[model samples]
Structures are given as structure tokens and as C-alpha cells.
Target: MELKKKLFPFFSTVGILIVVLGLYAFKSDSATTERYVAQTRWENLKVLPQNISKDSLDYLMKNYALSLGVKCTHCHVPSKTDPTKLDFASDEKIEKEIARGMVKMTNDLNALYFQPHFPEPKPKQVHVVNCVMCHRGAVNPEKYLSQMGEMYKTYDPNRDNRKEMFLEQQKKQ
Candidate 1:
């Protein structure tokens, strides 16, 4: 009976030591993994600015869209393989038309309004818009749903009624 009791305490002590060793190993491994990941992320961010070229931008945009769980079709017309599609919708058939229209609008604004007031050069580059400009830090599903819901309510399709409703809502804020 005494031998069994002594063995029990010895086994218990060994088991506790094993558990403590396991926990220490696990914690060490996790810290090492986190540091490795942080280093990799830091390297990626360092290279990102240097790697930003026309070809790289195209690749990055596609990858960025994928990372956001969307495709170029979300912001651009799928039917038009070209970047400069008239309609930004998925089924747009016209090119140059929408692009030209946007160019003209921007030009008119710059020539008549902006140049006279601001003394800035007319924007020479075509502005490629993306999701991040609006979404910013919002990465979760619930946040997206809530933001989209609010946007829809503010810009509701029932123009005649909702215009006043939106204005009233805006005024309240």
C-alpha cells in the first residue's frame, strides 16, 4: 500500500512536469511563428512600394480584388475585357464612350471650375478607382452589410419620396 502511494505521487509529479514542458514548448513555438509571420509581412510591405509598376499594378489590383473576395467584374464590366469600358456594369458593350465621357467631364471641371480657382494642372492620368478608397478598414461581413444598408437607405431608388426622406435623415445628423 505504501509503495503504491509513493508511486502515485511520483507519477503525478512526472505527469505535471510533462504538462508544464508541453505548455512551455507550445508557447515558445507560437511566439516564434508570430515573429516569423510579422517579419514576412514587414518584408512584403518593404517591397510593395518598389514593386509598384504598370504591370505590377494590374497584377496587384487583381490580387487585391481576390483578397477582398471579389473580382474585377465587381467594379468593372465583365463583357468588356478592356479596362476602358463605357458602362462599369458587368454587361457593358461600349468602350471609349464611357471613358471619353468621364474624360470630358473631368476636363470641363478642370478648365472652367478648378483651374480658375485652384491653379492645379488638369489631371493627366486616368484615375483607376478601387474598393479600398471607400471600404478603407472595413474587412468584416457584418460591417459591410451595415455600411451597404446605410448607403442604400441614404440613396434609395424611390427618388421622389426618398430624396426628401434622405435629406431629412441627413439634416437630423
Candidate 2:
């Protein structure tokens, strides 16, 4: 009975230790698996981080859609396995390449102009320029000549006169 009492405490401690170790191993394994899964989740990510969370990627994609006034089909092709679904990794559409270039440009601009002055007070009201700055909720932004023509009403450019011709040609309405 005395030995049993002594053994009980030792066995209980060992059992508790084993359970704790098992839980820790499970947690570590799951964490590693999660990281591996995250890395594999994204394919053909030339600009965006491959390990970006689904929610963050979705939010960014939705933002891009709104900014450019386009749907997912504008840049993504239909999946081979599932025609109804988009193949996000596919580069079948030229628009995707264009979009990637635009993303790189925005990132470069932000890094050069806005990001460098961060945490400090911004020099201007607009700290960063994004797709919305140029796209203005349009798939193709209004021509610069048209915008300038509308703004100035009577300013005619004589340099090649292409702006004038573009301005006179339906004025991009």
C-alpha cells in the first residue's frame, strides 16, 4: 500500500508530463503544417507575398476590382478543372501582366514618395497614389487630353496636335 501510494504520485506526474508533451508536439506540428499550407496556397505570385493570408488577399483583390471597375474575369482565366471557377495562377490573360506591372509601379511610387516619409506628418493630403488615383473607377481611364480639354475648355496644344485631334475626336465622352 505504501509503495502504491509512492508509485501513484510518480505515475501521475509522468502521465501529466506525457499529456503536456503530446499537446505541445501537436501544436508544433500543426503550426508547421499551417505554414507549409500557406506557402503552397498561393501560386505564381510575382508581386504579392506568397504567404499572405486569404482574408488579406481577398481584401486586396476586392480593392483592385473596385479601383479598376473590373470583375475577377478581367484578369483571371477560367480554371481548366472547373470552368466556372477562376484560375488565379494562370497567366492566360494579358490583363494580368498589365495589372502586375501597375502593382509594381504603385509599390515603387509609394516606396519612393510616400513610404519614406512615414510616421512623420505628410507633406500633402494624399500620402499614396493607388489604382484609384489613375483608374478612377474605370476599366480604361479617361484620356489625359480629354480631361485637360474639359478642364481648360480652350487650351489647344500645337505639339504634334495629337492632343487637339484627340480632344476634338468625340472628346472621349
Candidate 3:
């Protein structure tokens, strides 16, 4: 019984040490990978963190991709010199510019709506809207009023007579 008691304490201490070491190794390995887009050297970042670590940047990008059901190439364009590598700094892709605008819009909406205005009592959450709220893992969300599709028809905004004349000529033939 005395031998078992002594061994038990030693084993417990070793187990705790092992767990701490394992966690430390995991955290360091996850954060220290070489990043093409460095946290400090970022440019053209409008909505996302201007100074974000590589791991954090990757984490956020993954969430955004999952939210929209898209790959990174949906917003970021590949380098012309090397198609495999992404041109992170370039805004040659119009979608990237549009994404910045979308981020701003969503943040603004959250600021206005999601924030609680309780003076006396504090609320639980600062629950803000994310892209996933609307997207639900889709590039384009399915229309709620799909049945009313036929009701809305395109009207020609032909203020000039040229478009009308062109259609009229086509009818005669």
C-alpha cells in the first residue's frame, strides 16, 4: 500500500507535466508557421485586422470561406507569374474590393441592431451578425420569395426611341 501511494503521486505529477508540455507544443506549432501575408506587413486591409498574426488570419479566412461556401480564390486572385500562389496584396480582383464593402456594411448593421441599450441591467451577449447568418454556406442565398419570380418582370428603361425602334423593326420581320 505504501509503494502504491508513493507511485500514485509520482504518476500524477508526471501526467500533469506531460499535459502541460503537450499543450505548449501544440500552441507553438499552430502559431509559428511561415506566413506569406505577415501580420505587420499587411496592406489594403479595410475591415479585417490591420495587424493580425498568420494563424489568426488563416482562422478568420477559413470561417469566411465556410460561411460563403467558397474557396480563397473567390475573393483573392492568383498571381500571374505563379498561378499556385495568391497575390494577397493585389486588389486586381473586383470581388475583393466588394468584400471590403460588405464587411463594413455588416459591421455597421451589427453596431446599430445587435448592441443592447440596457442602462440598468447588463445583457448576456454582444451578438453580432456574421456572413453565415444570411449565407448559410452558399455563395448566393436561395430566394425566400421564389414563387413570386414571375410577378416581377424586367421593364425596359428606354427613354430614347432607339431601343423601341429596334424592337419594332424586329417584330415586322
Candidate 4:
């Protein structure tokens, strides 16, 4: 009885130490596992940031498709092995290159014109133009000329002075 009583405190401390060490080991292992699990490494990333979140990248891609009146297949090529599934990493399509160029152009435009220059930035909702502004759900924005007027459709700047013609038309309006 005396031996049990004396060993009780020592045994209790040993058991508690074992449990604490077990918990610390479990926590460390889980943290290490989580670091690898949380990372999503993409294959090819050129224009956009490599570490961009999947949701943000998807949103941006969907916007491009919507703006150009195109589907995922427009920019992404179908997988050779699986015909149904898209291989987004493949730059086989010329459209993808064009899209990259357009993205770069918009980014440049935004930085040059729309981005705030002042140290004390004005609290204004400054509208930044994007693909939608020019494309407007059309694959070719040149089609917009048909809706503008017949003069726009047939007008050749080489022969006719565009500035003079536009001024005259605006004056009549």
C-alpha cells in the first residue's frame, strides 16, 4: 500500500508526460502534412501569378470566356488521352496566346491610366476598362461598327479624313 502510494505520483507524472509528448508529436506531424496538402502547384503560369488561388484564377478565366463569347475549349486544348477533358496547361491553341496578349494589354492600360498616382488617393470608384468594354460578349469587336452606322462600316481613313467626317456627323446630330 505504501509502495503504491509512493509510485502513484511518479507513474501519474510519467503518464502525463507521455500523453503531452504524443499530442506534440501529433500536432507537429499534422502541421507538416497540412503544409504539403494546402499547396496547389499548377503546371504552366505565364501572365498570372503562379501562386494565385484556384477560385480567383477560375473567376478570371470565366470572365475571359464570357467577354469573348467563347467556351473553355477556345483557350484550352482538349487532352490527347482524354478527349472530353481540357488540358489547360497546353499552349497548342493560338487563341491562348492572343488572350495572354490581351490580358497584358489590359494590365498595362490599367497601370498607366486607371491606377491612382497621388499619395493621398481620392476615394472614388474609378472604373477600370477590361475585355468586356471592347469585346462586349462578341468574339470580334469589329462587328460593333455595323451597329454604329453605315458611314462607319464603309469609311476608309486612307481616302476620307476621319476627324472631319466625325465632326460633321456630330454637328448634324
Residues 87-112 of candidate 4: C-alpha lDDT, one tens digit per residue: 99997666777788788888877777
Ranking 1 against 2 by lDDT, winner: 2
Q: Model 1 off-target regions past 4 Å?
A: 1-57, 63-67, 71-119, 126-129, 136-142, 145-153, 157-173
- Summarize candidate 3's per-residue lDDT along 18-39 as a digit string, tens digits: 9999898778554446544434
lDDT of 2 at 21: 91
RMSD value for candidate 3: 10.4
Pairs that clash in candidate 3: none
Task: Report the alpha-carbon TM-score of model 1 versus the true structure.
Answer: 0.23
| Candidate topping TM-score | 4
Q: After superposition, how far is residue 85 of candidate 2 from its true place, in Å?
A: 0.8
lDDT of 4: 0.78
TM-score of each: 0.23, 0.58, 0.56, 0.59
lDDT of each candidate versus the true structure? 0.49, 0.79, 0.72, 0.78
What is the RMSD, in Å, between candidate 2 and the native fold over all Cα? 9.2
Candidate 2, residue 143: lDDT: 55
Candidate 2 — what's its lDDT?
0.79
